[model samples]
Target: MATAGLITWPVTLTIGAGHLLAHNKHMRLLRSFGEALEEA
Candidate 1:
């Protein structure tokens, strides 16, 4: 129902945001590690 969806939208958004943040953090760490390896 619309009402249920409205209540859940914020929760869904939070979950999606967490996922994106996690993936971004992982990619950033990988890039940093690769750069460090190249330097060495």
Candidate 2:
């Protein structure tokens, strides 16, 4: 199990990082959209 855990840990971290990056991108897009609406 130790070996399995060691292998899976990086995969888990990669998935978590991907999720965080996607969330940040989405938030930025929403912020830009809100700003455009305020300008209009």
Q: TM-score of predicted model 2?
A: 0.82
Q: Return model 2's CA RMSD, one decimal.
A: 3.7
Candidate 2: regions farther than 4 A off? 1-7
Per-residue CA lDDT of candidate 1, range 2-28, in tens? 356655767777888999999999999
Which candidate has the top score in TM-score? Answer: 2
Residue 24's lDDT in candidate 2: 100
CA lDDT of each prediction against the hidden true structure: 0.87, 0.87
Off by over 4 Å in 1: 1-7
TM-score each candidate: 0.75, 0.82
Backbone collisions counted per model: 0, 0
Candidate 2 — what's its lDDT?
Answer: 0.87
Residue range 1-40, candidate 2, lDDT tens digits: 3356755867788888999999999999999999999999
